[model samples]
Target: MTTRAFCLEPEQLDWCARLRTLAAERFRPLAEHGADGRLNRPLLAALGTERGLLDRVFPPDGTAASALDLCLLRESLAHGCTEAETALALQGLGGSPLAQFGTAGQRERWLPGIAGGRTVVGFALSEPGAGSDAAALELAATPDGGGGWRLTGTKTWISNAPYADVYTVFARTGEAAGARGVTAFLVPGDRAGLTGEPLEMLSPHPIGTLRFDEVPVTAADVLGEPGAGFGVAMRTLNLFRPSVGAFAVGMAQSALEAALAHADRRTAFGGRLRDMQSVAHQLAEMATRTEAARLLVHAAAAAYDRGDDGIARRAAMAKLLATETAQYVVDTAVQIHGATALQRGHPLEHLYREVRAPRIYEGATEVQRSIIAKELYR
Candidate 1:
């Protein structure tokens, strides 16, 4: 009998270890040359070819989707090659709406390119005025008096923007207040009136701003129901947000391992650092917290895969705890390793930069807390 490869239980350890090896030995080298947030096409192509990860993101016609597998892949990749992990995650995020709700023709045109890793995809939602408050979005998609709409507005801090071959865009179509007024569209990069420029940000993620100057789109471009796009957006976020926490747990685990190794080897005051009570206790705390965060992430992912009704609160809690724990763990690792950890090329230095952004992106820690509170009261 064949084993279930993507199980949430301990049996998946071998699979996770294999992924870790690939990330460190193969993906990390390619990620090093990614050039500060530009589209790393070559790197993506390589990952797509390795272990068939690309196929999983944009699966074939009838295969079932599995959230647990998605979380497992993200956590394993982030442990060694965070850039590659982020690239894969963004593909899943941008392509998912169409995978779930796009017209038949729309899916036929984009899914193949995405699965082959030959196409870059972007999620265009956040605007200058609607960062955390997504319901306040103002990107206009006015009816063209026929069966289409004219998009006119701007989207900022979009992941994989400008350079992405396609975008899953959310724009305002109805006059209702809050999220009810929104609609989602599938817009190709070559659309005449659409243009964008990259933003210089702290994280080396391919984030930018998009301008839509009356870009024309037809009824065929609509994703799901015209005025119910917020539901589509939220459904996608519910699945991906727990996996974001998985990414954080991976980084925290990596930091904890590095600290443990350093403590066992580096001698201080006539003995190894591990012999010191204070240092030993800190290591214990880091390990304990990392494990706890990982468990929360796993439970959340499993709940999503099971289609559990409580997934929103669980996802928010997982992302909030795991991201905050990663920041603390990585910071503590830097402290434990002394000044050398801050050197430019050090892995810890790279992690120090990478860890802060997840807390803010894909719904900030504050946003996650609010979501949990709302779900609780409901």
Candidate 2:
């Protein structure tokens, strides 16, 4: 039997050990319940507020956490609860810019609730026409005469849009037409004319589209400089992209575990599945790819923590490799499990669906390739 090896520093290993215990004790039950279409929001809220997991990676002090710490927590949480992983990840993503650049008042108003799980936060950048070409967004934010802004446009494929209390929304600030015109706003979900509708996905979560018909915002809500929305969004992605890889690593780890457990117990050709050279080779390959992906994710996280400008490139690399590798690993696990993997409620089956979205989100594989090419040529 191949025992999964975690590649983490000693301190991160300790943190992961604690996080795993918490996941087993708390999140696992919720995850099992959620499997039957029961999403326990109150339970998640309690975990965030009472258990203190939301603040694990994003501390109150604004000091950067080690990349290993972030990866450890993400992987551990994802192992037991992907919805909780999604919720926690969005908190980090939504509040990250504020942590990086918000005025004290802005941070005071939002960060605590986020850390306490009193509210949900979302990032709204993609539009009907602007996904991979993110800079081509057409959402307009015109300055209102009363010293505020009136946002008008539609954003699609927004994560957490259906339940978010606040959104880090992006829109056009200039007529130049491209990345230059983009600006970001901290739009309250309850603001007038701001509405969202849930989007059904292959793997379910609180994803949706956000519509703004003159949604209002004060200058106080602008995330950074008016023309710096693209930078903020990209910088935020650079910081969290490795964690996406970490999510993939976690899913892959679960799949590998399921496969190995099945292999050890299921007999075939007068021996256990683990005795077959073909199955052992496949398991070896899956393990190798998963570990390699973890290394890439950690290296990118470490680079960001060290304040290295190379983080964007490394993050893109990690996101690309880890998500694709996760797809491969999960598919192999499904094959190893044979008919059992196809059963609707199987853990491997769930992982199969969960692993598909990471490649599409965070910036698709093609976008990452372009990013790598551009960086290499530059």
Candidate 3:
């Protein structure tokens, strides 16, 4: 496989390095200036206008980007500026359905602003009752007398909620049960009866809950066929799952680099930390596991790009291993660095908080395991 070739092409490596530089030089400053737990509009604008990274995800040609490209972009951005990485990821996640399954009018209406970073979007799939079990969503989309539907329910843990200019919402359209009754809608944030409030989270990125008090949606707002929203959601997830792994790998790589730098400098026992056999071995393990996770992420992304069979299994494996590896890598780095790593503004401290969530969100670690097992049986 291309990913197994032992190294990314020279050009690809250069591209990743360039992206990392941009993340540090451009994105990080914007993130630092923004308030915690709030959507950073300036950072979004920088990604869209300055770097045009969002355009890579939602191309104007109405075609989906290769999963490998998404993976590389995410991993590189995440290596330097996680906030920037997140902003880009959320935009891609929310806009993917529109690019893939939306009507002409829908695409024409929304894609431009999304690409330019003037508009923010949210993926409103998770609810209190049905988060990991997405098909069991209860956001009711009842038929109105005028061929439209009225949405009434709550969406929790939504990224960019309450502030996004638009949302891609999946609701129960009652065509059938469990993965069949769902339908996706393109909801304008300013629409009446739809409101949201931010929730306090461990990570600084924006997240909140949305309340739909009979928000009205027209037939024009529906994405793809009625009752096919589950497929739409799954397709989106398949493309992104590996990239989520890439995000983890980026964080892992960052932590590994930090550990290496710290080990090289911090002296203990009359020598540098890196000089100790125990510390040296720990660094080696962190490097090995991080490399393994990176390989898994790249392989899954390549498989997805090729439309290979067992993509679900591969993606699940990548996400599971990489997220778990990131957690271990970050935690170990903190241990090696000791109490100084726990200081409020320490990079490791920020990473420690950030690392825990990837294992929980976008299909938790347990959920990924279930998916892999199910695919293997199939």
Candidate 4:
């Protein structure tokens, strides 16, 4: 199985090469089955644990990784398996707050299970009214008499919610509305008064709304300082946003490959589809945009890896460009395939849906543009 080559540093390139081999050997066979929407919980857990894919990229020991290396791993995984990619990404994001600010006991209790894939994790920060405007979260977490807290309200569009054992959830802790008053908590799935219902969507992933009604949480669940949930969320987003772009890069790369393959073999007007100037131009545009997006994504990752203070703005730009460009590239690939791309089980169709979610999650493209503009003006 020949894998695509990405321009990266020697170590980064080697890591990606190994990742591709692993994905081909393990994740490829599982991708389609996982996409069936039956929620293959045990299979996903076993795969993640056996391969150590989750632990390798996101170690709990505070070991630092290059942004480029992180992007390479994610991009490779996404190219071969969106389900695996989704699984790994959620683990990292869901557990990141704990890694970043949890008490030692909290980290010890949760990190090992997540690393071993024995437990799944989720981040539930998006509320019905707080998708892009995270500061508008209405869920309340008031202190209970026994030094614990009672949580009330709902979180919608939560990824990996149905299958996750734990979630890093945010709720209001202060009277000052918006970002300043929010606090983060680690909510275990089996806790009483907490319920989740799976949401069906165009894409096949475990997403749902979580309703918390007088759900009790101990002080140990608090992540970071009180009233610091917004910042913690922002910090996590800064790190993971580039991976979202990497996902786009992977999708676009797949689309370009499909387009090129079809253009070479499909006959049209007494010659190959590639012979047509229109087809050739479209392919060229797709390749160019894909490469450009790749560069931006990696560049942002590199900047973050270097601990650059300007990483937020750079990451936002990368996420914005890569996601929007991926949408275009995949749409063009579908166009080039004509009717074949529309088939229900075609890879292109899956890529189409997979490419869209990145645009809306993390931060919408419009939200990214605003962040970029704000940083530029500042």
Cα RMSD to the true fold for all candidates: 2.8, 3.6, 1.5, 3.8
Quote each prediction's TM-score. Answer: 0.96, 0.94, 0.98, 0.94
lDDT of each: 0.89, 0.82, 0.93, 0.84
lDDT of 1 by residue, 82-145 (tens): 9889989999899999888887888889887786788888888899999888888999999999
Candidate 3 lDDT score relative to the true structure: 0.93
Clashing pairs in 1: none
- Candidate 4, residue 343: Cα displacement in angstroms equals 0.8
Worst 10 residues of 3 by lDDT: 1-10
Which is the better candidate, 1 or 3, if ranked by lDDT? Answer: 3
Error of 1 at 126 (Å): 0.6
Please give the lDDT score at residue 110 for candidate 3.
Answer: 94
lDDT-best of 3 and 4: 3
The better candidate by lDDT, 2 or 4, is 4
What are the per-residue Cα lDDT tens digits for candidate 2 across 229-302? Answer: 88889988888889999999988988898899999999988999999999999999999999999888988887
Model 4: which ten-residue window has the lowest total lDDT? 35-44
Best candidate (score: TM-score): 3
State in Å the error of residue 148, model 2: 2.6
lDDT of 3 by residue, 99-174 (tens): 9999998999999999889899999999999999998899999999999999999999999987999999999999
List where candidate 4 sits over 4 angstroms from the true fold. 1-7
> Candidate 4, clashing residue pairs?
none
The residue-level lDDT of candidate 4 at 216 comes to: 94
